[model samples]
Target chain A: MYLRGVKELSLTRSEEDHIKAIHTLTRRDGRAATNAISERLSTKASSVTDMLKKLAEKRLLKHEPYYGAKLTLKGEAVALQLVRRHRLWETFLVDRLGFGWDEVHEVAEQMEHVASEKLVDKLEAYLGHPHFDPHGDPIPDKHGRIRQRKTKSLDSCGPGESVRIVAVSETTDGLLRLLDSKGLRIGTTLVVQEVHAFDGSMDVKPKSGSAFSLSKDVSDHLQVEPS
Target chain B: MYLRGVKELSLTRSEEDHIKAIHTLTRRDGRAATNAISERLSTKASSVTDMLKKLAEKRLLKHEPYYGAKLTLKGEAVALQLVRRHRLWETFLVDRLGFGWDEVHEVAEQMEHVASEKLVDKLEAYLGHPHFDPHGDPIPDKHGRIRQRKTKSLDSCGPGESVRIVAVSETTDGLLRLLDSKGLRIGTTLVVQEVHAFDGSMDVKPKSGSAFSLSKDVSDHLQVEPS
Candidate 1:
């Protein structure tokens, strides 16, 4: 992977957003389609195509028409920096500023674009270098090193098993608020009472809170490790 | 005065910089000249004129070709918000993140554009509602109420009078570094030993440090309260 100095990492807000969208899409589909990127950014496909070409010229990504795009090594490094900034700011917002997990994403989105290496370093030190954000997503370190965790979807656990929520994949504010209302969060332990094969929903009892039935959709979003 | 919601305060980076320049110049000269604003921003006079007209059309400023530009009430409010954000971020950098006073300005300049009112308010609370920034400039509150201080330039103090540093007006890094080298900073107390009529220079003795001489240019930048 290529590494770049902070000075060389200057990008407009739109460029950074496109790079991040491509990174996220690549993680899910192994390649990022122009249409998918456009959809992600709520922009037009033609505009996405134009941006893809510009990124290609800048050596951030490689794009082929009617096919897909992929972040180059240099591109991945930049994208990781953005991710690191985003998660670090989110951690600071929630841990230091008392913002709820659901409320930090938008503010962090703006903070991520500040892009000062020393500022980020100082902020990381100020926040005690948290390894994971409030949403349970691993925060990439300064060197783009992400802490790995062994976890599976809560929906995948069988009946009578105990697990601790490690991360939640679909991090919509609505989903996060729902989980909060249900007293489910990162590190919350649950004992599965039963999993209905027909509906794929499950009845789980939190170690402290009473049992609650969660739909397949909600359970699928939750990731857990054996307790 | 026209009060605006946070959403209506949207301004491009360049626009914000221009507004800030106008506000600063107005404070110093009572009117912001296009040439002065151009020089401050390092842009062309024609470009500054175009921007002035745009701002006038937006009701942020009133521009008279030869006279100068003046901010409307709406413009002053926006400028105050920008100042509030800048000082608040500078305070956060120095008071919370351990950044040196000389190094926080550029980062704060970028951060002031984030334009998230809630984020700013939370940050104010997190920083314990500091009334003055690290440089000793008053930080405006949410309603743009600025803390007032009685002060005079160090150069203006008579011989035999002692004063405590309250603020440094021309906040260039070179000047700050020079002040740092001389053990001069906010709250440093100095007694004027002599004032040379020849070149506006003076000899002074700090309360603790050895006596020293300062040029008029250097002394003029220092604001001090009678001690």
Candidate 2:
């Protein structure tokens, strides 16, 4: 299906939020539950139900009663466009504007809603068309094509396996701060020294820095490719 | 009075639109009338009255029954911030991203509503803290201070006078296009050759180009400084 013009799509901010939330949820869990969407958006589940109904009426998604919501092709396209905008703005904020990678998310959230294709295209050019954002998440191209790399979570790596951080699956401020504190970042090569069976904490040595221990919670969120 | 933090002075998009509209109208007409604001925002006059009342309750502006609205100090501060954001985005679009000056206004309009003080400050730094926008209108500083310039409309210039185009009073797409068609732009130096008193049209010669005639409608909008 062809991507509709932003003007023709004309989704409200709340509708867009729902579309993105559903897209994220479905990608991670195979289906978007009403409760998950509500929790993600900090909105009441009833309000989210109403919004899903409205979006389904617009043919953006199919909301199956028990199975939850699934994005139609059109809905997926809109979500991709939002992701492109969000990641591109994030890149601009951190790369061009000197914003810390940790601080660009909230500002990029607002910038992403500016629905002008020309603006995005111009910005993409100005930024030299970065394939990945500062957080290491792949930025979708204009055609919604994302560059894929085979990787697994840091927690999945066996001891003595060398890996480079490719992406952080969860971008929460707390997690980013933790990564920053440990000098762990995208492209940081490390060898898994040991996995403690006791509590799932892993000791890893960086290519340049000393060894450090990371909890399972943090390792599970760090996507890494074999070095 | 100190400028309020953007979080403390959060305004809805509609409220921000009304404030900018009133700021523009009052600057040109001494007072912002309900009908004028309605026309400017393309909203009903009754709705304008309701919004005016809400803004009055919020201490942003004073709405008189027949006289119109006047901004309080707090309201003026908000308006200046918006102006700062709008102009900075315009400068970025034109100077950095290579958008035509005529095409930047609508996109900048959308961008100006992304209210992050740090984003604005960083953007100002990224754009070299431009003192004037592409249109030659002074960009307000972080403290709501504007760099003032002494200029008069081109229509007010007498024949035999040399001047430089400083700003365009009206920034409508049509006027900008008209100026573009005639190769007229901010900083273009011209000499008034003859003023046709009959139709208020004047013949002007650019510093390095052939002489051309400009209608009073056009000349009146072209602010010029003595060259």
Candidate 3:
């Protein structure tokens, strides 16, 4: 069965990038501003505007000149497909190819553009249908349905609270490398030893390791769920 | 050690396609004519000329307007890399993903453009450094060295000769499906039972299956080595 929500449409690589960028930006904000898209794509604002107009003309999104762009349902499907392909390739690189998590994002970025539904389906099966990527981000299913979890940032936990890292909200290479060095990963359980209110830093003890202090920047990006 | 002969060069998809087409054409003919490349890429001869000029300026190839295009050493390296990637991906699709041999070429064509040297290296290692692809064609080594085999066509064999399928020189989907339906595959042993010289039809008995008649067209593309 074809599980994709919408029929696969042949889109230019640039168009797919804009759709994904809009999807990511619109998730946090209701609409994606041209400036935000330009920054995300590292393209000029004028180019983003032209692309937005084109995407709007294609009925993939709604664009307001001064406001922003929001995805249509059709556009969201395409975005989800890209996300699925990206996350799957990331999982393959890290889990199967033995690549370090920090080094997989760039390669996966290039691989996600291989536009074959059948290839993705076979890969999903080969990977045993992983629910989450290496970074703990939920992978959208074939129908664009993402598994939802209710989790808060690690910084929100109080002293004595126990939690398990579910996902990292920020996945910059620096952040990933920092977490790797700290022996932190998805599913790592920790007990909040102390919360430094002054700087929003926290001392957290891993289930197996000694307590370590995490700066506000690091702790803020760590999504956790009560253990 | 880096297995690739030349440092990876960033190439546009179209540039990669042209380079690959020239490589394939030049294999049969000393030089790749504009019309041949145009036909291979399904583009206009004028467009092909324009691209050849651009590629020549990039020093990837030498373009003689009337004599057709010939790859420089750098261009051949690029072409071999593309071939390596394509064959490796095709092997992955068939050996790991369970895709039919007849159905993997198109998908591999799309995947071959993922321009990450690390990814390809890891993939080659993951596949245990496969020497040949699913179609029994030699997969170029990381250093762009293809394993050479001395083999003749099945049609060249006379009655009483024992042979084994080494590679299918023609990998068209139709041809592969025909081979598949006939229980023929790489490494399958066969004994020539009779030859009908009038139309070059030959009856051959598989080591395991019943004897079958193969037309000259089919046998011509089957590369075989004496058992």
- Candidate with top TM-score is 2
lDDT of 1 by residue, A104-163 (tens): 888888999996899998899889988999889998888888999999999899989999
TM-scores vs. true structure, each candidate: 0.97, 0.98, 0.96
Docking class of 2: high
Q: Candidate 3, TM-score vs. the true structure?
A: 0.96
Best by DockQ: 2
Q: What TM-score is obtained by chain A of candidate 3? A: 0.96
lDDT of 1: 0.90
Chain A only: TM-score of every candidate?
A: 0.97, 0.96, 0.96
Residue range B1-227, candidate 2, lDDT tens digits? 33665448778999999999999998998889899999999999999999999999999998888789899988988998999999999999999999999999999999999988889998999888899999999999888889999999999999899999999987999999999999999999999999998999999999998999999999999999999
Deviation of model 2 at A223, angstroms: 0.8
Model 3 sits at an interface RMSD, in angstroms, of: 0.8
True contacts kept of 3: 0.83
Task: Give the per-residue lDDT of model 3 (tens digit) for A1-227.
Answer: 23355655788999999999999888867779999999999999999999999999998899989999988888888999999999999999999999998998888887888888889999999999999999889899888889888999998899999999999875889999999999999999999999988999999999998999999999999999999
Sort every candidate by lDDT, greatest first.
2, 3, 1
- What is the descending TM-score order? 2, 1, 3
Q: What is the C-alpha lDDT profile of model 1 across B1-227, one tens digit per residue? A: 33455346577899889999999999888888889999999999899999988888988888888888899888888898999999999999998999989999999998998868889999999999999999999988888888899999998988999999989997999999999999999989999999999999999999997999999999999999999
Residue range with the least summed lDDT across 10 consecutive positions in model 1 chain B? B1-10
DockQ of 3: 0.84
Q: What is the C-alpha lDDT profile of model 3 across B111-159, one tens digit per residue?
A: 9998888888889999999998988888888788998889999989999
